[model samples]
Target: MNFALGRYFPADFPLHRLDPRAKLLGSLLIMVGVLGARDLPALGLLALGLVATAALGRLPLSLVLGGLRPFFWLFLLTFLLNAYFTPGSPGPLGTSLEGTSQGAVLTTRLALMVLTASLLTLTTSPIDLTDGIERLLKPLRKVKVPAHEVAMMMVIALRFLPLLAEEAERIKKAQMARGVDFEGGILKRLKNMVPILVPLFMSAFRKADLLSLAMEARCYRGGEGRTSFSELRFGLGDGLALATSGLLALVGTIW
Candidate 1:
């Protein structure tokens, strides 16, 4: 399946209509709540909130869950490390009960964080996201932060995700056609991936080089005098979204 993490699914929904600034800040607040969650109940509440948001946005359940696919191994590794290393009462298979609990909680937190970010990208276009970020960071100019540059870099990175995923998929298929076996023991699979990874890196670099050339050709300067075509305005929807996110953050942190 195609990677869906950073790809926006256009839809006329409440979330898609909100200002990107609100969505960005709301996602941050939800992340804070995810981090502050100390127990399963808090985690469950946050999870429910995410599901509700997804539902409100009319996002497909499959697409939302698919965003988690890329991190499956990371989640597994995190759980295993915590379960095996954390000191606690003894439990099944030489794992501690506390360790297992901690592992579960930590994994859940990680998943929640990823889902929050996925929702943000799914709802907001890259252009709006960049504008929102730059505007939000404008205050930091007092401290000499390159807000526009930073926002541009961030959005560029996000925009590259789907491109890279597609490139990797193409390379994998080509290798498979050449009888390259990706299915094997862990070590063998790792060794087999070299062919795909090497080509993928080269393709990525080439794409980056082309992008730079295209920018230079257009006489592109920094965001110093940049003007946006669509000015973002905070409306009632933005306020309500921020308020709800703030409430959730408070509950997660305090409860």
Candidate 2:
């Protein structure tokens, strides 16, 4: 019910005031750093950086880590696969020592990656994010890339995440009220999900259809000659943020 991912949290802070382009680029840099991390120390540094960024944004710890809730299964699966299958010496409970270490490292990297991305969306508004992405891709226009359209599609997908989550939750409750048992063995649980999935897909298509109609009614056209109310300007803060992120990325790569 409390969807935090992709939903902007309004606040007056340094992170909130940062230009969207800066945030996007900075987040990407941090993600690169996360990928480059090969040891516990490197991962610790990345984790500290994320905590600091969250602090700068004045975001709640709960909100910052809340993004991981949805990816719990992913993290678990990644760890399990690595721990059970990777070649290494014996470890606790039949897991290899090397495999366990590898699993922990990989899981940490993934968590950091998710946190970085979530923080970007948490701090930046959807509109600003769209503009930022479009502008970043603007140079691709020379190569005939539909920059604006691509940006719009990405943002629209993010916006729909919470809507779909809420819709699924509502459908689940409704089905439960009608005597649908969602608890049982794996097969039974999966079978019970049929009712939920069918209606969810139907609702999604219906919403998409309605959206298309609304756009047509508004005389919607591509971003050929559109102008924005607020122009994006790179200022001192943006430069500082980019420089710091660049430094972090370099350290991650070379260290």
Best by lDDT: 1
lDDT of 2: 0.89
Query: What's the number of clashes in each of the models?
Result: 0, 0
- The global C-alpha lDDT for each of the candidates, from Candidate 1 onward, is 0.92, 0.89
The candidate scoring highest on TM-score is: 1
Clashing pairs in 1: none
Per-residue lDDT of candidate 1, residues 151-246 (tens digit): 989988988998998899899999999999999899999999999999999999999999999989998797888898778899998999999998
TM-score per candidate: 0.96, 0.94
The alpha-carbon lDDT assigned to residue 142 of candidate 2 equals: 97
Q: Per-residue lDDT for 23-104 in model 2, tens only?
A: 9999999999888878878888878888999999999898788768878889999999999999989999999999999999
